[model samples]
Target chain A: AQTVTQSQPEMSVQEAETVTLSCTYDTSESNYYLFWYKQPPSRQMILVIRQEAYKQQNATENRFSVNFQKAAKSFSLKISDSQLGDTAMYFCAFLTTSGTYKYIFGTGTRLKVLA
Target chain B: DVKVTQSSRYLVKRTGEKVFLECVQDMDHENMFWYRQDPGLGLRLIYFSYDVKMKEKGDIPEGYSVSREKKERFSLILESASTNQTSMYLCASSARTGNSNQPQHFGDGTRLSIL
Candidate 1:
């Protein structure tokens, strides 16, 4: 079974500090995509960063980055220099490219960027 | 820019009432999806359409149905609204690329309250 796990239910970080959100997924497919999505309070979610399993190098988008470990099936998001606007619910998602189009999402981590 | 719009941002429906949540995407994406987001459970896919008038069941498709009469529109229907079904409904669209996982563009979710 393919499942994504976000162990941290909630997290807080001081302004200008960095924090990491943990996510671990179980999948047998060698080639796939992992993504970090941010959902602001009472708003829709948007893609933050994406990483392809085949790439050894991690994916980074501005202050957001992902540590994608294919063998271990772990994908975690790191936020650098947290800002007030960054307060939102962060979700980790996995998508298989095997024509099944099965996308699995984790129970999100609510992140708070404190002043 | 891709714009995905849900008909309503908040909806209230009584028990036993039929409900419809509409989604329209202007990007001409071939794939459309419906998902319910609940606390701790993450986002569970209810249904998805790869083409006009074609839909497939997702992880939790019970108590729900979908229609894609047009390529740009996908509608999720609840046969009978129940309290358990009260959650944030998210509609997403993505281009179908056979070889890679395409990131989904989401609309502002509809928060439905079944009372």
Candidate 2:
């Protein structure tokens, strides 16, 4: 069983600043995937970024990027130039390489972007 | 673009009532998932189906059942709704391939209130 952990329950950053959300996971599978998802007030879950365990390089999507340390079992999300729209609940997820398509998610971190 | 739609955005139900949550995906994804989101619990998977008529239990499958009669549709069932089940329910779909690294697409979610 894989378990994702988000130590930070709440995070706040000033507008136009940068913020990082920490995440860690425990999985015995060598091949897997890590993902960052955002949920806004509308209650819509949106994919922020994803990283493949086999790939050593981190994943970056515009202002969202991930710092994936496979050995440490850490995958953190970084949001640059944060805006008010970035205020949301962020969740980290892990997926295995097996045929199943289930995700293990962390408790989530509520991010607030201050103006 | 993948589109996952839930049948309802908000639902109020009575205790011990049978509840059904419907989800439909237009992207022809082979994998569909049902999850519940709670404040400190993150998103816990209830059930998932890899193909039509094939269902699998996730982390928290107790008190929950799922049906997948069609490829694009997945339904979550609560035999007896309880107040503890009052939470946001999320539906998601993902392509079933290891090489693709495809992230799951989610719907806006259904806020289910069981009283």
Candidate 3:
């Protein structure tokens, strides 16, 4: 079985500051994918960033980046220059290439950007 | 941009009533998914379809059924709505690319309330 864990349930960041949300996962497969999704108050789940397990380089999208450590089984999201619009529920997800390609999601971290 | 749209943004149903939630993706994605989101549990996959008329049960498929008769449309059905089922339901679609790095495009979730 695969499992994803998000340690922090809630976090607050000052405007224009940086914040890192921690995530760790347990999976036996060597080839897989990790993703970070943001759900704002409007309840739209938006893809922030994604990383392939085979890639050593981390994935970065605009102001969001991920620290993916395959050996440690950890994938964390870092938001630089956080703005009020970044306030949302952040979820870390893991996907295996085998079978139907289902995603295993971690319990989310509610992030609030304070001005 | 990929667009995934749910038929309803909010819904209300009664106990023991059969409820249907509809989703459509315009990107011609071969894979579609339905998920339930709660306060701290993040998103739990209820069901998914890899192709038309092919479905698979996800981590939390109990009391839920899904239909995908068309490539662009997926429908989730609740046999009997319950209070516990009152949560945000999200629909997502992703291309069936051979690589595992494809990120899912999600719709604005439907907030369902059962009384």
Candidate 4:
């Protein structure tokens, strides 16, 4: 079984600053995928970024990037130049290379971007 | 653009009543998922379907069931609504295989309250 862990329960960052949310997972599968999802006040889950375990390079999507360390089993999300709209609950998820399309998600971290 | 739509944005049900949450995807995605989100608990998968008439149990599927009569529709059923089940329900869909890295697109969650 794969388990994703988000150690930070709540985080706050000033507007225009940068913040990093930490995530770690335990999985036996060598081939897998990691993802970060954001849920805003509207309750729509949006994709932030994703990383493939086989790839050594980290994934970046504009202001959102991931620091993926395969050996350490760590995948952290970084939000650069945070804005008020970035305030939301962030989740880390995992998908194994094999088996049914079942996703394992971590307890979310509530982020507040203060102006 | 890929879109996943949930039947209701807010629902209020009485305890012991039968509850049905409907989800439809227009992207011809083969994989459909139902997840429940509670405060601090993140999103917990309830059930998923890979094809029409094919359903699979997820991490927490004990009190729920699913129906997939068509390729693009997946429904989550709560046999008997309980207060504990009062939470936000999220529906998502994605391509079944090959493009596994493609993120799951989600609908605005339905907030369910059992009174």
Question: How does each model score on lDDT?
Answer: 0.92, 0.92, 0.92, 0.92
Cα lDDT tens digits, model 3, B6-82, are 99999999999999999999989989999998888889999999889999999899999999988999999999998
Q: Compared with the true structure, what per-residue lDDT tens digits does model 4 show for residues B5-89?
A: 9999999999999999999999999889999998888889999888899999988998899999999899999999999999999
- In Å, candidate 4's interface RMSD is 1.9
For model 2, what is the C-alpha lDDT against the true structure?
0.92
Q: For residues A1-115, what per-residue lDDT tens digits would candidate 4 score against the true structure?
A: 7899999999999999999999999988999999999988876889999898999999999999999999899999999999999999999999987765888999999999999
The per-candidate TM-score of the B chain, in the order shown, comes to: 0.96, 0.95, 0.97, 0.95
| Chain B fold agreement for model 4, TM-score | 0.95
* Model 3 stretches astray by more than 4 angstroms: B99-101
Residue clash pairs of candidate 3: none
- Rate residue A115 of model 1 by lDDT: 98
Q: Give the TM-score of each candidate.
A: 0.97, 0.96, 0.96, 0.97
DockQ of each: 0.76, 0.69, 0.69, 0.70
Question: Each candidate's interface RMSD, rounded to one decimal?
Answer: 1.1, 1.9, 1.9, 1.9
Local distance difference test, candidate 4:
0.92
